[model samples]
Each structure stands twice: as C-alpha cells, then as structure tokens.
Target: MLIGVLLVISWLILLIRYPTKALPISMAALAGLALVASWVLWEENRDARYLAHLELRLSYDPQQCPGDRPLAVRLKNGSDAALLELRWEVAAYRPGNATNLAQRLYESPRYSGPGELLPGASWNDCLPLPDLRSGYRPSTLEFRAERLQGQFIR
Candidate 1:
C-alpha cells in the first residue's frame, strides 16, 4: 500500500515534468514502478542485514549426565545491536519425535530488567528435567528464541 502511494506520487511528478512528450504517460508509469521497486529492494536488503547480525544455536552435552539430566540453553548474540526484550523456550522430546514430553519457558535474567544483549555476548541457562516414568528418555530437544514483537530473529 505504501509503495503504491509512492509510485502514484512519482508518476504524477513525471507526468508534470514531461506532459508534452509523446509517451509521457507510459514513461511516468514506468518511472513510478521503478521507484517503488527500488524502495522495496532496499528495504529487503536492510532487513536482511539486521537479521544477519544475530545468531541462535542449540547445544547439549549428553555426556554431562548419565541418563535424565537437566536441559541447558546457550544463547549467543553475534550482532552489534543489543537485542532488546528477548524470550526463549525449551522443549524435550523423544529425540526424533515431534511430540514434547516436557517444556519450560524462561525469561533470561540478562533481559529480565529491561535488559539488552550486547555484541559478541552469550548467556547460559539451565532447566532441570523432572524424573519421568520408566522408558521416557527424551531423544530430541528444541529451543526457540525471539524478540519482544514476535520476531524470531535468531
């Protein structure tokens, strides 16, 4: 919608500038389309840069525990801009299955008091897994990271 408005304005400007030209109308429309396309492409490039500034990784050491152990999360920030208002969740599943046996949501202390993540910084948090019934070992675990506005930048 915004691009449309911009294109219309550009077209009007071109038409006003070259009203007597043989193909003034067509030229104005094409110029307007070009302007809108350029704007869209620039915005997409900017968003890509912003996204590239951050990274998310999930890691665990199975050897750290004998059998059922608590889950540990490692959030690393690789961007120059501090990530404001970050939230994370951890879920345990039967390794390869999609069903989650246990899940926990935690707000990182680093960002608890309206904090932000600085560049090249990292945080480690742990959540203890409860004792499960026999034959309930989680084969897979998943972690998700996102910003305050539901933007999954990581």
Candidate 2:
C-alpha cells in the first residue's frame, strides 16, 4: 500500500513536470494494474469456480434405519480434477414448515463420505443425518456443500 501511494505520487510529479513523457509511463502502469487486479479476482473466486463443475443429488429412505433415515447422496465430478475431500451440511424440513427440523439448524454438523472422485466420475454413499429431536421426522432433506477440496489432474 505504501509503495502504491509512493508510485502514484511520483507519477503525478512526472505528469506535472513533463506531460508528454508521463503519458507512456501512465499507460504502462494502468496495464500492469489491470493485470494484477484480474489475477487477484481469479484467486479469490477459485473455489467457487471449481465448485460449479460439481453436481449433487439427494435421496432419502425412511425405512433404512428406523427413526434415523440416512440420506443417499450422489456426487458427480464434472471438472478436470480429482476430489480429495467433500462435506455438506443438511437441513431437514417437514412439509409446510417454514423452518428446519435439524437440532442445530444454522450450527448443524456436516456429513462427509470417502472422497476420491476423478474427473467425469461419480460417487454414491449414504451420509448420516444431522442430529434431530428424538422421534422427530422430516419429509425432505436439503444439502449444501461446506467443504470441497480437489486437485487438477495432469
């Protein structure tokens, strides 16, 4: 930040002293600034960009485990990377209810499965549901990926 302020000050001084000479220098600095801004933006949104290539589907079987109905999830990797770890937070909601039945709701626990998903591959597993009130049941489950880690495959 200090360096940027100093550069701006020097550039302004040059512009006041030699207007014609400062024109080319100002143009070069503007181009460099644009390049740096673009790189920084890409770095900040890298995770979201890669996550766009992933898809998730949810299915639930109420008869699978008595009071606790584990969710059957299907994750498809559409990117050119191998996924190392993946986890999601689930929200359980009953029909006509405007709120979640999960015990923690916003602070609910995350569920994960064995992850080694390669490009163009799919993984299927049953993830245990978050803690809910005993004997409480939800008609639907919502999943949102909270942890996604992957590497580009060469």
Candidate 3:
C-alpha cells in the first residue's frame, strides 16, 4: 500500500520533469516502488528479529528490600529459548521521597556478566542498599532487565 503511494508520487514528479519525453513511465514507477518496498520489508524483518531476541524476566524475593540490608534480585529467562548477554539493575527508592537515594548504594550503572540463560533459568545477585535516615523506610524496589543494547545478538 505505501509502496504504491510512493510510486504514484514518483511518477508524478517524473512527468513534471520530462513532459515532452516519450520514455517508459511504468518502468520508472516500478523501479522506484521496488526500491522503497525492499527497504520497508528489510526494516520490518530487522525489528521482528530484535523483538524475538529479547527474553528477560525480573523479580525480587521480598519485592521491597529493606534499606538497611543487602538487596537480592532474580533475573529469569521467560522465553522458551536462551537469552545472551543478560544485564539487570535493582533500583531501591524511599517512599514518597523526591530525591533519588538509590544512587548512593549502587553506582549509576551496575554490571552483571556475559552469561547465557536457558529457558526457565535464573541468576541471583545481592546488592547492598544505602542506609536511610533515622525512621525512614523504603516503599518499593524496581528491577529492570535488558540486553545491553548492541552488546550481544541472538
């Protein structure tokens, strides 16, 4: 559908440029449309491949780890296939606090490893949490899992 529209527009431009020429307009239209259609197909295939390669599941033991102790996070592969180069982070936040205190414990970006996870497999890592102010409590911990962009291919 998009290819047909682009081909029509391309032919209109060609007609405007060579009004007096008796050249084959259909050939020009087909060539232009083929190039655009090929590009669109290639892009769609690449995106599908990328989505299929992503298969990381993240969870925690307590859901909300205490600020006074080390935090444990579990990373699992939810897909039937294995995932390569899995990386994750555990972000602990104090409830209703406007400031970002998790940075004080774990660095801005934490490194896991270059390992493979089979179907229904998981890995656990313990990260120390930053001490809170007197009487302060944490609301929740957020875990994010993903393949370091462009670091590995499935």
Candidate 4:
C-alpha cells in the first residue's frame, strides 16, 4: 500500500515537472499496476484469520419461537479484527461427534458494516428445523442437522 501511494505521488510530481506525454503515460501505468498489485495481495491475505474468533449459541424456546421455528442461534464477534465475511453452518452431533445439519447460511447475508464486527456485537435469528423430533432420547442415535444452529470456525 505504501509503495502504491508513493508511485502515485511520484507520477503526480513528474506530470508537473516534465510535460512529455509518454513519460506521464508510463508513470500512470506503473502507478495503476502498483495499485492493482496491492489490492490483490490484500484480498488474498485479509480473510485468512490467524485464530478462531466466532462465538455461537443455540436456543429452543416455545415462547420465543412459535410455529415451525423451534431453533435459533446467536452469533457474537469475539475477535480483534472485524469479520469481513462468514461461512456458517448449523448441525447436530452425537457424543461421538457424528453430526447432522438443519440450515446453512453462507456469504449472502453480507454484513452492512464496513469490516467492523466489533467485539461483543451479536446477531440473533430463528432457524428452520426439519425432521427433528422434540422427544429425542439420549440413549438412542438420532440425526441432528435440523435442530442444529451453528458450525465451528466460520
């Protein structure tokens, strides 16, 4: 980024001092290339989070969720960096870590904030559950995709 800015500034200075058309064009091209390279590098590295920073909670309340909506989740941002995007899933798992999923929301619901999912900010919403029984037993095996509300690590 600094290099790109410097290139642009140099181009501006050259345009002021030297009135040659080819010189200005060459400097402008170099500046544009620098800008593009910096943007590409940022895109490739910015989303690679160094550590896990997503917090999720599942809830099922008859009063809070009427009708077919029996599952919901609250997502909290607990990272130092703003969450630019999220690839989230909701699943059910047994004690052995076998699992099933109910609903999945990907990068479509883009955060309106500009890379600013500040710490402690949370989002809560109801989820659609399908083919899950309320009377599930602990002793028996069951599929869990429907009642699950979140996946790990974005």
What are the lDDT scores of the predictions, listed in order?
0.53, 0.68, 0.53, 0.52
> Model 3: which residue pairs collide?
none
Question: In candidate 2, residue 54 scores what lDDT?
Answer: 88
- Judging by lDDT against the true structure, name the best candidate: 2
lDDT of 4 by residue, 1-154 (tens): 9999998798778777876975868878889999999998875454444224556565554468755555555667776555654544345444575554232344312122223355557777666443433565322433232211122222
Q: Quick one: how many clashes does candidate 2 have? A: 0
Question: Tens digit of lDDT per residue, candidate 3, span 1-154?
Answer: 9999997788778778887562575668679999999999986675455435554433344445554334555555555555566444434444455554444343344646437766566676555444444454443644344334322234
* lDDT for each residue of candidate 2 in 1-154, tens digit (9 for 90 to 100): 9999998899799999998998988899899999999998876476566667988776665565444546777788887767666665666666666566667666655676455778789987666677766777545445344445444332
lDDT of 2: 0.68
TM-score per candidate, in order? 0.39, 0.55, 0.40, 0.42
Which ten contiguous residues of candidate 2 have the minimum total lDDT?
A: 145-154
Each candidate's number of clashing pairs is 2, 0, 0, 3
Residue 119 error for model 2, in Å? 1.2
Best by TM-score: 2
| Candidate 1 backbone clash number | 2
Residue range 1-154, candidate 1, lDDT tens digits: 9999998788678767876772666877679999999999986675456546656544444655434434555666666556555544434455567665543334322222125666677766554453333566444444334332312233
